[model samples]
Target: MEYLPNIIFAVALIVGIGFFARNVKKLSRNIKLGKDVDVSDNKSQRWKNMAKIALGQTKMVVRPIAGIMHVIVYVGFIIINIEVLEIILDGLLGTHRLFSPLGPVYNFLIGSFEILALLVIVAVVVFWIRRNIIRIQRFIKPEMKGWPKTDGNMILYIEFVLMLLFLTMNATDFQLQRIGAEHYVQAGSFPVSQFIVPLFDGLSESSLIFVERTAWWLHILGILAFLNYLYYSKHLHILLAFPNTYYGKIKPQGQFNNLESVTKEVKLMMDPDADPYAAPVEDDAAEPEKFGASDVMDLNWVQLLNAYTCTECGRCTSECPANQTGKKLSPRKIMMDTRDRLEEVGKIMDANKGEFVPDGKQLLGDYISHEELWACTTCNACVEACPVSIDPLSIIVEMRRYLVMEQSAAPTELNNMMSNIENNGAPWPYNQMDRLNWVNE
Candidate 1:
């Protein structure tokens, strides 16, 4: 019995550390591949954001059921570590009963943990049903139809099983202690386990011992394996989410990256360069690069990383009015396209062992389409919906800015709108002085 605790602890520690190290390396590689981003600019804002999003879970609460359930499970997981520690101590140290101090307080802790465990199990089961059986529209994709559906479901199931195992193990232990043994009544609470005591009344001493040993091993091993499995799956978010949330963008969603000014020698040849207010170009001899994304390679590292980080939660696509109205634009598709293009180009680049460029065609014209770019209202619904803080609207706006400023190619309506804004201070074709014409004077 004493050897069992040592074995579980040794195996769990080694496996946990090995898995953690391997995942850390993979995460480091992913971070290195990301584009240079400035997330440390506003110290106060970052702290405030962390407090709200991480501690308070402000954004998650928008979906009450899911949010509340997740919050409960998250808190439960953190607090239950103490219980796990106690279990380990009892198994290895021959303590049999743990947390026997502060009679009422200990009982309360046990009771609360038991209730939370039950709740977590229930919540996880509902989550699985929601993702698989209920098949929520927001969770599915047409392209995902043929893919294996077990990854998400499996994680949820593992969590459910772990919680159930914990409860069962604790209940059996509590029953044994109540039968004249020094029960580790750490608190005054134990409602569920107390009720469970009746079931063990008819069992013989040998049967009770077998049940205790089995439940302990199952609960501990199940939890340890689940922890290790987290690194290799989407459940990586369990560790990655905190850092990702802390490093999120602090700027307004609509702002685009500012382009740098050209050199003096090149600036003289262009007429706009001679004017102080005019936009700068690279050089007099340098040909103008086409505006907007030409291909997947043109995306910055952060944009490329965004593709990998997407959980396929479909919040972006669901919030997109274009997708809702039956248009070709799905923000989710845009993300997937970026990922696919990167993989395609990466393959060619690796095969040739050199930088590879696609044959002449532009990404917008060939892959994304001019209509799709024009369809965006810049409403920023996708920006708000993203759980990982990927800013699709910023990408769209940057591309739109490139089209208008560099290519001078925009939709007919946009062209007219720009002309009106340039000459009359508004997109409407009305006199600037008469802007308040509708007001009763």
Candidate 2:
């Protein structure tokens, strides 16, 4: 019975990690549902891009105020978690500050963690103010109304609570150690928590121990719960941003990828020497199942990765020309819709024992409207603004391709232009003989 606490901690760790791993497997499966496109061409350049954008936060700094605040939270949250390793060991072995043998080094590290914890709290508070009181335009967009707004605030609250618990745990431990309480070691420098230690000045030794123990347990368990929460929140970008930036689109922004089958048909049409009545010689390679993305399955894996990696910070939408012009297409919403559809598809696969059963819904018309797709100007502003290099434009173009090729439902003006191209070899209705008539006259 003495070992029961350790056993419980072990089970909780295993269960949290196991459930997260299962979700990761499901995430990978969903991403791979799309067609494969090779993004392995550039190694060094991809590395450089990832380092600059993901690690350096290059794009995020374009707006200094929010960027600085975000950097504080991101850096503080990451660095403070270093102490969690020691916490894990102490929990499992039932030791008090197990790294105390490292003595001064451990003290310095704990001191640094505490300082960062304070900074994280400050940053989180600023973020809350920005979202609520200051009311940033991007945060208050139509698409951010319901769950998205709640999720943004929820993460900040989680960070605030976790930081408070850490300081409380440290403060109580400091008081307990001063009284030479049993198993309360003289360890961990408390730069910020020292001020709070005075709050427990009048408490009895047993009550102090209760406070410390409760804070310690809650801090660790809260971290574990937060780890699991990433799957549901936009905070998953904290992990995916590196990979997303590394595999970001390498080609020119305006250069659209042509379908290979369509290219071959075009080549055949242009070849005058080719036999018109010859028997067709088939290639061994299998043809693509779909031309363009009507659903998530038709998109490439990189596009799916882009969808999942979205920070939902609205930077893309804020910079989008269509959105600026009051159009219905928010690039942020496109990524959100794609991710929502992918998640729905994943849930259906789970319910059916790992095989997907269609539910009469598609990403194009169901989650994202045709009007939204048509509103895009293909201006690449959203792509340029994404801090993590999530290419919402690529998904937009693929859906547009599906609308044009599969559905033949292009806007009337677009249809007219395409018809002009087919008949007169340009986007004008004049005959070829009349091409130079205006010049001569």
Candidate 3:
């Protein structure tokens, strides 16, 4: 019976981690649902990109204040969780302060954790103010209206509560240690939580123990809850940014991926002496009949990865000229819609036992629109602004390719240009006979 608490803790840990793993599996399947493209080149450069962008957070510092605040929350929160390892060990063994034997090292580690936890609290508050009081323009954009807004604030609240619980747990434990209460070891140097210890001064030993136990339980359980919550939150970037950045598009930012099949046909047409029915080149067999992305499956895996990696910070949309000029396209929204549709597809696949039923919906016309896709200047501004190296423009271009190729749905201006190029070898209607008209005039 004495080991019952340990058993319960173990069960809770398993369930929490198990649920997170299941969601991760589902997420992986959804990402792989996107069409394959080789991102295997430039191994060393890819590693450098992952290190600089994801780990070093190189792009985040563009706005120094928010950057510093995010660094505090990000680094502080992550470093503070070093204590979580100890907490887990103690819980599983039914021990109090299991690492107390490490003596001064343990004290320093706990002290650092407490300091980082306090900084995380301050950072989270500033983030809250940015979202609510100051009302950052990006946070208040149209896409941020409903669940996105609520989820943003909800995560902040959760972090605040978790950090508070940690300090409170330490404070109550400190008081118990001062009173020499049983099993409350004299461990951990709580530099920040020490100020909070005096609150429990007048409490009876039993009451102090009760408060300490409650805080401890809540802190650990809350961590577990937050772990699971990541799957449904934008916070998943904390995990995915690594692989996403590694597999990120390394091609020149403004370069569009050409349709090799179309290029081959054009080449053959240009060569009047070439055989029409000759064996297709290497790329022909693997080339998709449909030229561009109409659905999540039509987009390359990297674009889908970009959708999943989006922080939804609106850095992309904020930099977008089309959005500034009041066009309906928001690059952030494009990524979000892609993610949403991918999720919907994933759920359907799972429901139908790993196969998707025809849902009468596609990424191009359904989740994203002609207006949004057309509005993109292919400017690569969103790609440049993204902190995590997500390329919303890539997805935009792929969907646009579908409009021009498969559906013949391009706007009149583009169609006319293409026609001119085809007929007169230029982007003008003048034939070779009239080519010197402008010169004559």
Candidate 4:
């Protein structure tokens, strides 16, 4: 029964990791539901983008106040969690302070972890205040009303609690070491937690050990739970940001993707020698091609990746011209709607055993309204504002494509412009021969 604790630790570890892996598989499947596109060009540029944006966080620093605080939380949390390796090793082997053999190096590492843990706690508190108390306009947007608000606060609460548990565990360990308790070693420094050690005074060695064990168990378990919770939270960016930035759009921002079929027809029209009614080859007689995306499946895989990678920080929306002008088009909401619809489709597929069944719902006119879509001016401001390189504008343009080509339901002004362009070779109601009349007037 001495090894029973190790066995239970192993089981918990396996279960946590197992559930996380299952969620990853589901995420990948949903992303792959979109049509494939080649992103293999510019290998060096892609790597540079991933390194600069994802690893270096260059874009995040564009806003100074929030950016610095975010960096502190991000860096401190990551560095503090380095001690999790030590925790896992100790738990598995039933050894206390297994790395203490490293002498002063272990002490230095512990001291650093303690400092970072404190900093992380401070940063988390600031973040909570920014969301709830300060009531940032971006945070209080309509799309952030329900679950999004709750998820944001819940994450902050989790981080705050996890950091507290870390310090509590260290404080109890410090006390146990002072008492020369069994299995406790006089190793590692605790700069911040030393203050916490005073609270453990007058307690028996047995009580100290119990407190230490409880804090230790809770800390590791909480980390595992946070890891698994990423599947449901916008914090999925924690894992996907690297890949999303790597495969992000590399072309010029204003340059749009043209439909190959439409380009082909236009080219033929300009070819003077080409027969207008040429007999079609067997391959050319195939069914007509789809014009644009009416649903998530019609979008490219990279766009789908963009949806899953959205941090929902609302930087995109905050920078959007239309949104700033009180338009219904919130760029953040576009990405959120896409992700929600994709998840809904994925659940339907799961219920049907791997095949997607039509649920009489689609991304357009359902989760995302035409009013919101038409409000966009295609200014690319949102694309530029995304720290992780998410391109919400691409999805908007594609849906607009579906509206114009598939349904011929473009706004009246747009239809009139197209009509004038087709008849007069210009976007005005005048004959091509009378183009010089403008100068005469």
What are the RMSDs of all candidates, in order?
6.1, 2.0, 2.4, 1.6
**lDDT per residue, candidate 3, 1-441, as tens digits?**
999999999999999999989998998899999888888899999999999988888889897998888888888767877889889999999999999989999999999988888999999999999999999998999889898999899999999999999999999898888889989889989899989887887999999889988999999999999999988988888888999999987889877777776897689799989988898778767855788788999888888888888878899899999999999999999999999999999989989999999899988788788988888888888889998989888888888888888889999998999999989988988786787789868
Candidate 1: stretches off by over 4 Å: 1-5, 88-98, 143-148, 180-188, 198-201, 260-310, 332-375, 395-441
> Each candidate's lDDT (Cα)?
0.68, 0.90, 0.89, 0.92
Candidate ranking under TM-score, highest first, comes to 4, 2, 3, 1
> Each candidate's TM vs. the true structure?
0.72, 0.95, 0.95, 0.96
lDDT tens per residue, model 2, 192-294: 9999988888999999989998998999999989888888988899999999999997778888888886788779888999898877666624564466789
Worst 10 residues of 4 by lDDT: 73-82
- Which one wins by TM-score: 1 or 2? 2
Q: What TM-score does prediction 4 earn?
A: 0.96
Worst 10 residues of 2 by lDDT: 282-291
Q: lDDT score of model 2?
A: 0.90
lDDT of 4 by residue, 1-441 (tens): 999989989999999999999999999999999998889999999999999999888989998878888888888867876689889989899998889999999999999988988988888888899999999999999999899999999999999999999999999999888888888999999999999898999998888988999999999999999999999999999889999999998999999988787898789889999998789879878987788888999898899989999879999999999999999999999999999999999999999999999999999989999998899989999999999999999999999998999899899999999999988899989889987887979
Q: Mind giving the per-residue lDDT tens digits that candidate 1 earns over 256-351?
A: 566433233355655563666556555644765444455655555566556555555678888999878877777776765555555556546556
Candidate 1: Cα lDDT at 167 = 67
lDDT of 1 at 303: 68
Clashing pairs in 1: 35-302, 106-186, 106-187, 107-186, 107-187, 107-188, 107-189, 108-187
